[model samples]
Target: MSRESITPNGLNPDRETIQLGKLTVPRLFIGLWQLSSTGWGTTSVTRVRREMRRHVEAGYNAFADHYGTAEQIFGGFRSTLPDPKVVVGATKWCVFAQIDITRSVVQAAINERKEKMAYDRVDLLQFHWQDYSDRQYMDALEYLQEFKNSGDITELGLVNFDAARTDEICTQFPGLIVSNQVQFSLIDTRPLDGMGDVCNKHGIKLLTYGTLCGGFLSEKWLGEPQPDEYGGPMTPSQRKYLDVILGAWGTWPLFQSLLQTLQAIGGRHGHRSISNIATRWILDHDFVGCVLVGSRLGLTEHIDDNDRAYGFRLTPEDNAEIEKVLEKSKGRELVRVLGDCGAEYRRGGGHE
Candidate 1:
């Protein structure tokens, strides 16, 4: 559908918000991962702040994961708002190196996020640990739990954690951990291997990213030829998903077939675009609490098209049509080939 032809209604809180642990958040979150690196280019502080306000006003209240100066920028914008509590920002405490985990050290890290976001308490604090060999992550979580008890953090979550480790943490922590952030999309369906079951068993919600496959699942790429992954115009996210598409999932022709199938199914549902179809497909799963779609902040916005992904349910036939294309590819084999939800990052599989 053309930009002028696409007419989606305003955001509905009833349809969009879900009970994520102790907090109620929009089912669709504005991802700040793009602001983490310059591989996706940069926007001015003023422009970024303006876009942040625009997103919250449109009812996309939840923001997920920040790196670089995103926290400061978001903090600045947040301070100017009349009601900062309306915006929910989730930041990460990623431990890339083994350290002597101390309560003071962990408290200092939490303090930094609190200071950067200009909020006394973080809405959600998502944690990631690179090396599972070290058992100190437990100590870190122990401190985080203490802070949570003290009301310095609202809720706790995980990022890129596999099923076994996730189960371990949840079993150890019980009801304290509420969500697990992982890569879940039509192209990267590794979560289906076991993460979904773990989340269900533990009553944990899966907050997903890369649902749109970095814009590769949109109408713009429906009939186009594959671009040079390392060449002009491909952003960091596109490169990451493209590597999975070409290397593991299937050929470009097969991906095109999947896109064509999505386009046809979308035509049946009020002429919604391919992106909406993909987003709705992921959101259909009962275990999914939210799908984090990357926003370019001031550079680009898809609020209208994204809003359509909600308030509508995909039929069984729509799912059957999608699965037909999926069964023809090697999507199911990703779990074995790439390991679990986060094997690429841990095993040097070159997925960015």
Candidate 2:
């Protein structure tokens, strides 16, 4: 579809909508984690606006960001856009018992982020709880509920909450968690093992990440020559992640076989790229509402590429072969390795 022809429809869902107290975000949300201050990454206001405009044109309306720097970027971009309502934005509140974020501190963060986004009410405010054990979980949740009640946030959500803890929050708070973001890809199917049933019962959606295994799922790594290292001297996060997949999944030979099958599937769907198959493989799973694909803004242009995903199905034979390879591979506690969903931010980070 041409950029001029896209509309705010199911073909490309609206940025936000209300389903009970929960807000249904766009099928694809633009994530700005790279814009975070913790990283040395940089983005100009023009580049940011152009990227956002392209997303809007491609039928994505919702955006995800936790960085204060991202807030300022969106603020500046929003000023340039003709209509910002097409954009529904999400920011986060950290469960600061680990960091000692007081209710006042939480409120201050919300107010400050709202000021930066120039939106009085955030469409969604996802809570990032670092440690689950502290009884302060209740306290942090209550503050979030209050944030929702006070109109500072439109919907309540969680990032990387474990199944058991997420269930407790669901029952105790009644309507607090509309969704939870977790790392789930064909490569990582734990969410299906436990959380899927739980979320199905509660009418909660699972927003997944790492489906492409940081671009390892793409064809570039398929039959191509191997680099000296995963990143090939300063590897992108996605490339390094494919290395993790190699360690856990199998040798390059096994991965290449899986790629062959994925290529066949993509061919059947008229998507010839390794990435098309890799992304479609996960999108076919149950209980996944959306998958967060990363973009480097000015550095990359895969938004249109992502459109190739989800246009076809992987056959039972295909799934069985993929599973066979996975079953043969080394399995480690990825959570322990990478930290829970956004746990890379808490403390120093285990991967480095």
Candidate 3:
């Protein structure tokens, strides 16, 4: 576990893989949400496949939360591997509208994913429900369970579901669900409220995203002035998380203080980058399973910097110092202000 002992293809196995049902996945997952749209920029399929190989060789073999042509592109890359099972791929079936939750409807969703991925069964199928009032998500989940029973899916998970519903659904289907994907970061401490306890009670693992706040939680933005949301080089993710930073979490000045604190903590940990410290803070929690880092693939990459996230743990002094800045902000009050983990999406703040 020492920093000097860590290798490129080797990492702390315990920290590298977390239990996700019967399968073990890397602690860090490569998120393909950027591939869902051109807002993050575009690249050739050849470069993307090359980047996927680089990630695998670098010890990150799990991928998730893709959309549009992401699944198909991932399918092509996965086929090139010697053994396809060497990688873990997760796809989503999001219901943003009110529709009948039929068995065939569920089958068709899975079928399309499988056909796109060129696999007979999906490695992981995450479900997202937009409207909580409809309650048909339960029906969809029930049918998803039926698919699992028939071996159409190896694992079932939730995307942007609140803690209350996560607890309820897990109780209704005991020992069925494996993971719940949610937004968890230093600024957005909503998961720390009730979601942590719910995950513990149900034996569920949290696949967390926005751990770096859409690349805002880094040294690049440490002392920089807040950019205008209307005119800037900010990506879609940056725009979304910027609202959380300046609007919900705290003022721009307070966030700068946090970044400084993180910088200091990173200095204590042998000058690890702010992103490493931020990700380490989340991975340190026992309830968390993986931190999903969004990568623009061919356009850009942080594989080496991100790889440094492992082989280090935050000390009590480090956390205490980080919390000093957090106390001045609205960090702990996010759950009350924004409801639960997925309230940002449900409350019309747009998706994470």
By lDDT, the candidates rank as 3, 1, 2
Per-residue CA lDDT of candidate 2, range 1-352, in tens?
A: 1223324434523132234245555555677765653232466767876777777677766777765477777766665555666677776766554556469977887887788888777777777666656677678788878888889888877877777777888889876787888877756666765677777778777777676776677777778654556344433555556666665545677667777777776676675577766665656655566666666666566765666564457788767866776776553355556544455455543221
Question: What RMSD, rounded to one decimal, does every model reach?
Answer: 4.8, 4.5, 4.5
Q: Candidate 2 has what TM-score?
A: 0.83
- Point out the higher-scoring one by lDDT: 2 or 3: 3
Indicate which candidate wins on lDDT.
3
Off by over 4 Å in 2: 1-24, 37-43, 96-102, 331-352
What lDDT tens digits, residue by residue, belong to model 1 across residues 97-157? 7688999999999999999998999889999988889989988999999999999999999
Question: What tens digits encode model 3's per-residue C-alpha lDDT throughout 1-352?
Answer: 1111212375445347787997788899999989988999999998997888788878888998667688998988887765788888988988887799899999999999999997889999999999989999989989999999999999999998888999999999998889999999998988999999999999999999989999999999988998899887889889989999988899999989989988888988888999999999999998999999999989999988987798889999998998889999988888888889888778884654
lDDT of 1: 0.87
C-alpha positional error of residue 234 in candidate 3 after TM-score superposition, expressed in Å: 0.9
Residue 136, model 3, lDDT:
91
